[model samples]
Target: MSKLVFQSVAVNTDPMTQPTPTPALSAPDLTEIQTGRLADPFSLLGPSHRGHAGHLVVHLPDAQRVTAVIDGTAYPLAAQAPGVFAGMIPPGSAYILRVGNGSPENGAQEWEQEDPYRFGPVLGELDEYLIGEGTHQRLWHVLGARVIRHEGVEGTCFALWAPSAQAVAVVGDFNQWDARRAPMRPRGTTGVWELFIPGVAEGASYKYRIIGPDGRELPLKADPIGFGSEHPPQTASVVRSITGYGWRDAAWLEGRAEAQDRRAPMSVYEVHLGSWRKRGDRPLSYVEAATELVDYAVDMGFTHIELMPISEHPFAGSWGYQPVGLYAPTVRHGPPHEFRDLVDAAHARGLGIILDWVPGHFPSDAHGLAQFDGTALYEHADPREGFHPDWNTCIYNFGRREVVNYLTSNALYWLEEYHIDGLRVDAVASMLYRDYSRKAGEWVPNIHGGRENLEAIALLQRVNTLTYGAVPGSMMIAEESTSFPGVSRPVDAGGLGFGFKWNMGWMNDTLRYMEHAPIHRRHHHHLMTFGIDYAFSENFILPISHDEVVHGKGAMIAKMPGDAWEKFANLRAYYGYMWGHPGKKLLFMGCEFAQAHEWNHDAELDWAALSRPENAGIQRLVRDLNTLYRGTPALHARDCEAEGFAWLDGGATDISVFAWARFGGPGDDPVVVIANMTPVERPGWRCAFPQAGHWDEVLNTDAAIYGGGNRGNMGGVVTEAVAHHGHAQSAQITLPPLSTVMFRYRGAE
Candidate 1:
């Protein structure tokens, strides 16, 4: 390689047309640019000047001849060193690089392209300040690969935060995956590296090649704020524009903002999209699921559909719990816009969509946030504080301002970008406590030396406040299993600030009571009554979630200890009992029809089982239960209030029978529920009634339509003015074997 020097030569009177002296380039500059280790590639390459004329320098690794093309006129460039070319041109705003195969005689190959390093910084100072302060609530807009127009040229702008990295570059197919050609320019003190490549359009796949602070090359990392990604098994982030989606759910959104009251009926169908239903061996696309899932939910009378996590993950077995891409929806079904379409279609059909969001911990995949920039940037440095024992994953460093901002903004992203109705925050118990699932000496205490994770608490509170304040009528629900106080209360009032909490105690006790044989049920009758002790402690949702049926726990139907026929009857009775209980209801996908097999994330539900009368009957019973729950004010109007429920006879353990009365508001008649746990029928059982004229049997779980023995009151019974069970009116009714019976009070004749 030979060194080349240019002398100053005055030509024309016009400064723009005059030839000027060229700036000298050292050996270090050429080596740094060629080796892809330059922190600021723009300083040494692209358009520059020593005096009046413009100097264009480029590092084309394999080219023999290079030219600076200005207005279609090609100016031959002299070789400063091997693969390095420099030349002077008349000062101009725009130019392109033209190259030819090795020596002109060899005639290798040639191409012309716009220079990426010619553009100025794409982000403003405000973005840098906000991101540095960790208050950039709209960080996604600045950090991701976005298709943008710059300097009258159209292309994509890629930015990433890798403060600990010595250098970073954008590598993609456009550059033959070479990191040297697209080295990013680091903004001052912000730790952000950015580059705008002209002509790089949407759908281009890219990844960041980062050089760690120690001058060692790290594995290529996916864009943490990428809007889209290549389907799994391929980890490259794809440049996708999230705009231009036309939403047609204005009426639904308007009504939701005004009418999402706590007292209204909310029967949710929790569905794992991958396993809900499959087309042959493949899961349905978001568009297909939008129609199929929405219609099914509407017909079943469910108020909302709660989906398991849809964030991008490497392993399907995690069921989206161990997410990698917090911003990009998993491409398993479709792109980000299709997810918006699904949400819009659901709202148009009068069905609300709640996403199951996982923010507690993340999997320890190499390509993920683990050891990002060769440091514990997203997690704690201490193993006790950062590692999750149960999952073998990494706990987020909530104490870090940037990490907190990342998570909090992600919560808002779903609500604002995708129009999600609610967020069912998963594993909130794990986030609330520092010693979760850990024994003594296995965890570190907080600043106050208590189990509470103060940082996580503050993060949760801030996210909840932001969600409720920004998105009208959006819900923030917690799946917390601990006895943490006031989870659903306002943050100012000393609470975690959740809209509702999963009633895990109720689910556990009720399932335990239901698992007992008829002869042994009386001994454990308190289990069924225990939930009411703290039922109104918080706004609750009685969720029989997917967790109950997976692992070795067996299906809900199989959990009952009985003969096949008895099992079906017991499940039906339980369903009626749960619906009548005071709280909103949530049933997992297959549980509505009592799927015989435990839920398998890999396989679809047993839809063929519905052909069996027992299973079909369970389906019918659930549909009617939802209809009754929604239509009857006494059953749903005051679900979260104590005034709605009154125990009629919770102590009838000898015959294993329980009765309760659910009331609406004042002047509204009450509905009485009687559940017989034993197979033996109780005849002429007198139950209490608030009013005196007559009582109508509204639902009978043992009706022959539900695959139970046809046993119930004829139709209606007139109540006599006799005091019984602490009520002024009493009625003699026969309770069916292993059944639940509900009756509505009629006015005086």
Candidate 2:
């Protein structure tokens, strides 16, 4: 499949007259070189193959005369063809080629430069072997533009994968964007082209100029493995070195495994950095976020900070979801190192960081991976398998071994290089199904005639395996909505290996129930309790994500069915119930302070609203909730286990009051959570308890400090010996109107 093609150094792109044959060169070889195939440009352009010592050749198009400078002595070379020159200088002597242009009457100008074709390859045999087998875990190190010393010359070693190309040239600012010079050499049978261009160091912008197999020049393409890029609307890859960052998260890294365990409380504060806050007219840069954002999250008692995708994207309206540069942390917020500063700041404060990783699909931008190498090399040719109609993007060909390797290695790069704590993989449900968002006949079936996409499933599994194996304490959470079993189970158990799955069913049901008026909530009571049916099926996170507050969904506060006062009360009660529920927690940025408007990716959050008493009260309630959740073992220790929870009064649907007990290990104390969803208060109403003892009112959603009337059981309650609701002990407690209350048991004396 690897056919040889010749390199062209034609001075004029329009057809040129065939030069008369010389003793040193054949006409067929000259024709191929003039056509620009670049299969082995080194053989045709750089040193003599006819055993003539000190014989140097270079293709300097448009050069009227060429001279070799050795030891400050200039020697003229005879022109073999148009723009092609060769001559003998001192053997084994270091030299530079001086290109002379213009006529003698106008005065000639000379430009001296090193010959790019004189440098040997940076990619050795081992890289080729691993690349051919598609097993290179560190593919980024080899594919992208790496600034290094090749052949005793300081330059950048550029490589690309375009097997079907007739010729590939490195075109950029260094070479005045000329495609004729610096043609890449295709390694035998590897489909990879390599060229080391001297003096092209960091910060130089570049793109690949490729002539397709049919000799058709394709659009200049961005590097798929590029670590840095020019700010968008300008689609050139910038050479960057991502090494030598001194990370300060050694303590956090050592304790991360325990911090991410199921037993640990994971209270995530999800943020869209671009909209979380602003400094005057623009969003905060990564340097600004390092202190402002990290300080805010720690002060609010969040365990981790989950940022929406920050990868380089052309359109800001996509909110970073349709990323073009997977390796690049968007230049919108400073360079890659500043992003590291943000991560380092979080870890310094003992907080974990998680990024929303999108690997399912990408935009069909001209400079992106779509139609790369003038073929469907990264995506599938079939639309049914490779197109995402909903997003208007192209799906990656996970079935291709090399493509899979490329993606899998990218996962490790973030964790290993950036020291990020976790990745919440986005839109996993779409990747799991072959016919996602498609009707019958518009979709394709798998080899087994099923709807499951086996390749994508394998890709997801492999990514989870590799990331977890490489990063000890890192997590791979899934944004999956389907009922596919064992989503959080291990891969060896024949399941998709994820650390946690977003509890979409619980979110949808609970929000639907909360939307109904208090009077009507009794009839729709089953909505809130239905989630308990499969609550412990998989490790879950009760997420109030950005998706819930955008595109006409309204903000969290608006979703409540009540007047001004009741709205605040309802949200506080809901937050109480959510924190007490059996799962991890994740709340979007504005939700903590009850932002009035729906989320807009373009603007900053309405932070001034926090000055209001009601809004400040909501913020205080969330802080206390996080504090209580983390401090109390009974509240979080058994979040993923059935035995850790017990319902006392699920049949209290008529009263709209629910009570449950959360237990820890045998010796650890238990906490009781009671939620009164209705507006009506119940004074001296006997509620069941696990034991006959004095229970302290640990948290009261209706407390006066939280913008509610100070109405609840005073400090503590003592249980009487009256059997009630299948318990030997019952407490005569006061239930505030539309509130949630928590109690901690001391002992039975």
Candidate 1 achieves a global lDDT of 0.87
**TM-score: model 1 vs. ground truth:** 0.95
The whole-model C-alpha lDDT of candidate 2 against the native structure comes to 0.87
TM-score of each: 0.95, 0.94
Tens-place lDDT per residue, model 2, 357-403, is 98899999988988888888889899998999999999999899898
- Provide the lowest-lDDT 10-residue window in model 2: 1-10
lDDT of 1 by residue, 1-749 (tens): 11112222222345566346455667787788789888778777777732333787888777778776665556677788778888776666576777667554665666776778667899999999998999898888898899888898888999988889899999987777899888998999988999998888878889999989899898888888888888988988888888778989889888885445677889999999999999999898999999999899999999999999998888899999998888888899999999998899889888889999988899888778888788888898898989999999999999998899889989999998899999999999999999999999999999888999999999999999999999998999999998899999999999999999999999999999999998999999999998888988899999999999999999999998789989999999999999989999999999989999999999999999999999999999999999998888899888888988999899998999999999998877789999999999888998887778878898999998989898889976788888988989888999999999999887786
Q: TM-score for model 2?
A: 0.94
Could you tally the backbone clashes for each prediction? Answer: 0, 5
Candidate 2's clash total is 5
